[model samples]
Target: MTRRIRPRPRPKPHPHPLQLYSLRDICTIRILRFASSPELLEQYTNASGGLRTGMLMEHLDSLAGSIAYKYMLGPEVETLGRVQERGFYIVTASVERLDMLAPLYPVRDIRLSGQVICTGKSSMEVAVKMEALNPNRREETLMLGRFSMVCRNASTHKAHPVNLLIINTREEKVLFKMGESARNRRKYAALHSLSRVPPSSTEAAELHSTYLKYGQDDESLALGDRVWMGDTLLEKTMLMFPQERNIHQKVFGVYTYQLGFANSCLFTRSHVSFLSLDGIAFRQPVPIGSILRLRSQIIHTSPPGQLPAAVHVRVQASVVDVQTGQEEPTNDFRFTWTRDDGQTVPRIVVPRTYQEAMLWLEGQRALKMGTQIRGSRLQGRDR
Candidate 1:
């Protein structure tokens, strides 16, 4: 992919603090830790008196940016002036993984921390953890997320090299390996995505069996055993504003994530706990002032089981040009949620069209991979 490169002018005598340090220096200063007061949590709560997942996502994105900036810029040193004088911009490329281990309540104070765990030439992987604490109590981890960010020249929008991460401690080394594994998994999944190639023989056979089991005809639709593809789908449109743009003058990836996640939660309309978010791929950059159309659909639901049923939803965001009447995809998000009541509903999505079937199958693949990844992480932690 070719990126536009713009020429950057020489920095003036005074440069911003963001341009000062590398990841090494930034890690020492604890640049990615943020604390929110209980009052602040109260302000962010929804009508149901619970903290919204969208708000948490917004904070995670910001924390990821801070870590990326520090990794790219270096630590503040007055005597050394500025480590790198040229100002650069960083934007989220993708959110590889975000798992909500526990829900955050309004009574608890929130704390977030992020650090650069892996880096390429111009891209870095940031691991962000969110914790909640009650009055005079120890902190408990609520959620964890990983973000991939790319640095670019402020003017040209082309990729820029970032400082390499220095691994010293055994823990840091392990984290670095984890990040590398995540990156490799992402790459492999992308290369094997259904969008890139046709399904294998086994996958094709599975699809055929799925169609035979759940495919609805006119008579079946009337029986109410199946729901229309349009019935469970939800869509929202909003204009991207400058206030939500990042330093790169483009809409922040997290803003789109917040919109998609909130809409999915609303559509489910059940007391559901956030499980995981995966396959979040940013296809294109959303320009400021553009109209964004977000569409979400319940693609799959868990079978009848003793545990709470899991529902998988897919959200796609596209940029619409009002004058030209053209729309292009910007990002794709897949989220998994489990019913809080532990009620298993034998709900299966019936795709009315071939396009819908493709989407449904894609969601199935994503959910399987997400489950595997979560299981592997748990095993690692236990070890």
Candidate 2:
């Protein structure tokens, strides 16, 4: 018998301009051309060495916003006419699965890219990746994350329907499925979150034990084994301005994130390293000229002997009216940080109020989820 030879599969051709307007049309990527500089790092960093997590998050939100815009309005809407006529505004609904793979150094330029992987009625899941580019070596991935964005009617300020995403290739289809899985997980977590409902038997037992240990007598609390919920709080206010507005004339979501993260960092009271940020939900858009107040509280802290002491901080951003002094919630941010030093600190968070107790439970849930995800990823890498 003669030996048979098989031909290799040919590469798929790039789609034409007209064919690109379908569901796959919204799939897009963007690159930031600037490199990290000392001056730039100075603005974002604390007394620490390099860039802060807040700065990176700010950049990530901006990049995700750009990708979402292109995804919704198509590439042709680069001009103001198309934007005003048919374009709708997009807001960051939530950020999930933010994994900081490596530390970003100031000597390297950071390259950020993302694409719309999946879509719902009015929401799109944008998966973003950040890499550090060096002059003589390959790029190093710094972080990977997903941002959930919702389209809103320009006039009504309500969620509006968005274009459906088209998955053309098998790889694209796989990504779309993964995005869908993430969305479902988020919904499930939200539904079953301890903060959203009453505690279970085990959790109730734990709470009761904590109360008995700390609430029964003043002497037990005076042992200094626990930290008051009020002790690890930081608050600040800023005036929203037109300079920070998006196309919809509202304050930029990333600007609010920046403020929240900075305040959360201040609440840590130590050299902190970014671990993860979860469930950043935007409830309402901040109007221009409004006073935006961010209240950050450290709700949970790891006990001593846990190598890098983990800290959970929750930041609530609310808008205060100038004349009436009415305050309305605008957004909620949850950030996880670890002490940069390996010093062991016995920091126990004691919640004194019902609201504080709820926040503490929420923090516990967030930390548990983050740890599980991180562990699974690491195990996969090992395999």
Candidate 3:
């Protein structure tokens, strides 16, 4: 069947824009200083001796906040000001578009740098890069990513205005434009969400084909080289400890992210390298004294023969009510991982229901976009 619901129209841009801060004025850089301290370096290394990308992920959250506070507090400020006195505090709105440019090694120091590339009336976009600082060799960029942050009124809990950024140079203009494009892509994705709009003819036809091949309810379909998506899931249920809470009793986003990452790794069951983060939003955080059930699924995988084949995993963070035993979704995380040995995929994931089909298609879209980004970075080109 054809699509019964079409995408909504794009909103018009504001006529006159106010630009104030130069890209340089809001820039921030952090050095790991691991070269001098072996103990410090070990703290960031995983069991396989590779850098812990998971820890770095949480560090990015802190870095984003630090940059936002730096923008408002000016340079040379070493400590964050009290939120009560500042009248406002920054919170992470969403994490988006993280692509690994190269493998991170623990032998050298790494520099994390980013700046306020774009700003709205109450929102700001922070772009960050992680680079290996080589002493006698060329510096290698390890990662590139973006974070969306917003200032909130401490008392009112409403969106607060931030400093408007000024595009002073051509480079700054390019970054500002990229931020705008990212925002547009987010809107487009939401508009085409399966819940909001009907599937197109192509998607409908594909789902039908799958249904014909493997009947939905039949688990013993004698499937060869293929497995039901639900069978490839890993789940974990745990209580939020006091250390994980941030908002008095509400758990923060960092623990959710870490749990999601670990769940994906377990599902892969191999030495997988982080390819990219499709997206993660902190719409809601699981509260303390609540049971959190994190479900991770291998939604999509590359073809058998593609070198360095990857898998796309989606982790759903949900809170389970104790009394009624009902589940409430808190957040969803999308991640792409490549086999560290660069081996082809072993199996394919098949959706078993209409909802699974929609999630599978969404995973397909995220994988496609992530592949393009990773390709561009590896080829020394910008997308």
Candidate 4:
């Protein structure tokens, strides 16, 4: 794909305790000449003729990394250079969230942009945005997301400090604060994660209520229009290909994101509309040739509303050790989806096991947050 990069330059050096960078100094804008090239849009179009969100995610991941690397390696450098020679490499630590703002029309030219808005001792918060350009030169926001990236020393495999951001304007402070808040939230969420502690009392009570309603049926098991979470699983297994490899020669996280979106569609058997993706954590780097297993499940369902219901799904990406027969999980993806308004799902998702119950609660949390976010956006727009 041909790209038109927005011009940028760095007035600083090319070393460790890197120079202070303005937010604009690290910004990267890529124009996908879709309107000019009709032939290239076929691969990125979904079966329904809309832009494929999974493909957009791949671009976001790539753009975020490019912005991060530019921050560390300066704008004059076009390539990642040599990993070992450069001393450090960038990796996605986690994705805070990605929200669909407007419909992504397939025929429109899209612009992808990202910049390092905030930085820590070693980590950076890269904010990415997607906009669809119209014939009159108007742009509509299509998607917005934040990526947490960290640098690692190539030799020691330890956290490597990156170039600092020199926050100048009020807008820059707001962006920086958002990143700071996200980091704090991650720390808080990790502490309260199900792996480290039991469910809260309120969550336990909710799970008990679910058990009384769904688990009491001994014969049909699903006495009502609700199915066990275990029954809603869909899996995809594939070998990591060289084409999906990132700058570090590791399978890109975007592949996992795409797999999750595709698998979620199969779970519902519909052309699901995307709402949001949250709480993505990349635990391990998958080698280019590793075998990948993606397990997707419907973890939560909001009670039927005007739209019938909203499904909250989770996909776990794992790498299988061919020799030892071991499956080590590498990432977790949470997404929210629904069909067009007024359509209803056949059944609600219910958790029977304690483990699944915990996941149910986590998905519930994500759904609630996504709803609030969209609600606030709508409110702001209405004003």
Candidate 5:
């Protein structure tokens, strides 16, 4: 009898802001085959074979948690409370799906896999791949997307160094490469827009006074040191339903904000570590089966000392009826970040106008309230 030596299982990696699963972990992935179960359709999704964007976003939240558990924390996800004063930013999000045929009998199935693609000094990049898992059938590529988040000091809301990711497998390497390329593209794009998008004179005035108000506030929460501006294209299949009561069924304000949060975070080279959402209101309704195009821009940044080193971003989602080529305003949201450091300051020039300032002030108020409400909702939903 010959004795053979077996290789030892690799030690579980240390905790880091950006972490990837090993090859063995990727190999063991069992593709999940999920369709709109009859119950699921009857309970939630519309009859046109399209689910609400909010519902889709909720699913992504669950998926994010799953990714966090499997890759970030191995067997036991560390206990980190709600995104309170410090946390990560959601930079971008998009649903990867196969084409819909007749809405009732959608063909392809999608399996989403996500991981931290890279780690900046104070930020982390995550990539998610939605692949069609058809064992015996041929299907087209579904969707590919990535997000960036920044971690902040829990107390000061200042930017701080975070642990780098440890990559060990081929699949992880591939995702990492893709993230690098995407980030590089972002840098190139930013270089051309070095000059700030000059705000109208009135807008400028508002920014100045708005800072004063935040400066006056005693309960300010800063999430990051910098503000970012960017755009993300979300591909969604909108199914038309003639029987529904309202022709325009607006997407949830909260959902669009969160999704924009993910994309903007990624664009800013930050993680979705700590966030507060507020003043979420659905102004109007969006018709069913409309591709909602979302655009977000970093309008301002507060330094780490004024409050917390954080970024102020404004986002807008517009629903486009692809068939008719008509668009309608769907949602508008504002997001703020608290740096990790205890020292909160102004990172960007605060606008200097009454109206613009008032708007900023309102956004701040809404963000505060939104953060509390959204955080609670996220926690409750998770549980």
Candidate 6:
């Protein structure tokens, strides 16, 4: 009998310069060399209670803005006016947790990296990936989402043709194929409109009343800041409510996400495209009695308009403990404002307009789906 030895395969080289590097490498380079770095945790080091979710969402939005400007736009697109010259852009964003770590540190951090995956006559597809990066934990994949944006000529204000490029990888090719499916493709497009509820709905009307009652003249108004270019203000508050637990008194993910979405909308200027979001993370579980202080800051802005030349503003929120003044950021989100033109604007008289109403409905629907699955599992166990 004869024994044979096989040689190990050589490492393959990336085809392009961009392929050689990755989102992590880009984040590291930006951290070390760029003047604007990811918002440090030091700011919300002591915030607690309801404020934690708000602050985390704000941080996520800021992260999205930084990455979008750095990679997507050119140097010419610097001012608020330039950003507006682009079309109606929305920040379709979400957050996911990686692990259970101490309240003081991030179990995992999120990074938004998007590339032009494909193009059509008037629109383009951007494949965005969120990666988990922690100081002391193993790497993990959080989630993946795709965004479809249409670019137009700034002068004509009409949809223009894009020079669609061919994808280079087999994986990307497959994703593009899945995206091309009429049913799946429609799902992505319809999400924007489907997430909205009618302005006349009972819930929409209730939320409107709630906004007028509580958001109009509270001390929380003092903390408000200009997060956008046009006539818009951003106000935030962090508070707590009681909840039931199953042996372990843990805060619910649905509640946390809903809170994050609500706060993001609180200061958001209605009638604008919510373009892009980034750097969202869920670190520690918000426990009962934990006073969460949501500290939010308005960092950047773009032009405001409805003719595709709409401005986008970026905000970041971090959560901290009010009693001990220790921050345990549980979420980070981003929001954008798009002015309404004849074809794009929302018809509403109050703060809780039709668009806002629809958004709340869609959010509730998503939350219910998660709860239903959990309830089903619980029932199965009991049976």
Superposed model 2: Cα runs more than 4 Å off = 1-46, 76-82, 135-137, 155-159, 218-220, 253-269, 379-383
lDDT of 3 by residue, 1-383 (tens): 88799889998552222336688887788889788889989898887888888778767767887898777666667776467767777887888888888888788898898888888888888998888999987778889899988887778988777777767789889999988877778789889988889888987886676656654555435545577888877778898877766532567544444554564555455677888888986767677778988888888777557766778888888899999999989888888888877667766678877788888888877888887877866786432
Quote model 1's TM-score: 0.81
Local accuracy by lDDT, each model: 0.70, 0.72, 0.78, 0.81, 0.45, 0.38
Q: How many clashes in each candidate?
A: 6, 2, 0, 0, 82, 47
Q: Which candidate do you rate higher for lDDT, 1 or 2?
A: 2
Candidates 2 and 3 compared: the better one by lDDT is: 3
Candidate 6 lDDT for residue 25? 20
Segments in model 1 whose C-alpha atoms lie over 4 Å from true places: 1-25, 28-38, 77-87, 134-138, 218-223, 253-269, 378-383
Q: Summing lDDT over every window of 10 consecutive residues in candidate 6, give the lowest-scoring window.
A: 26-35
Task: For candidate 2, write residues 1-383 as lDDT tens digits.
Answer: 99999999998542212123344555445444346356665665555567666667777887788888777657665643444355357788888768776776766677787888888888988998888888887877777889998887766777777766667788898888979999999888789876677877876776667767764657856776677788777777888878877666787545444554564455445566777886687788788889998877888766547755777878889999888999899888787777666665555777888788777777877778788876776565456
Q: In model 3, what is the error at residue 337, expressed in angstroms?
A: 0.9
Summarize candidate 5's per-residue lDDT along 30-148 as a digit string, tens digits. Answer: 23344635554444444345433334334443454344334433434444334442233222222211111111123345555666566667655555444565667654333333455
**Candidate rank order under TM-score:** 4, 3, 2, 1, 5, 6
The number of clashing residue pairs in model 2 is 2
| lDDT computed for candidate 5 | 0.45
- Give model 3's clash tally: 0
- Between prediction 3 and prediction 6, which has the larger TM-score? 3
Q: After superposition, how far is residue 22 of candidate 3 from its true place, in Å?
A: 1.1
Query: Largest TM-score belongs to which candidate?
Result: 4
Candidate 6 lDDT, 63-144, residue by residue in tens: 4434333333432344333434443222322232111111223333544344544445655444444444555766343333
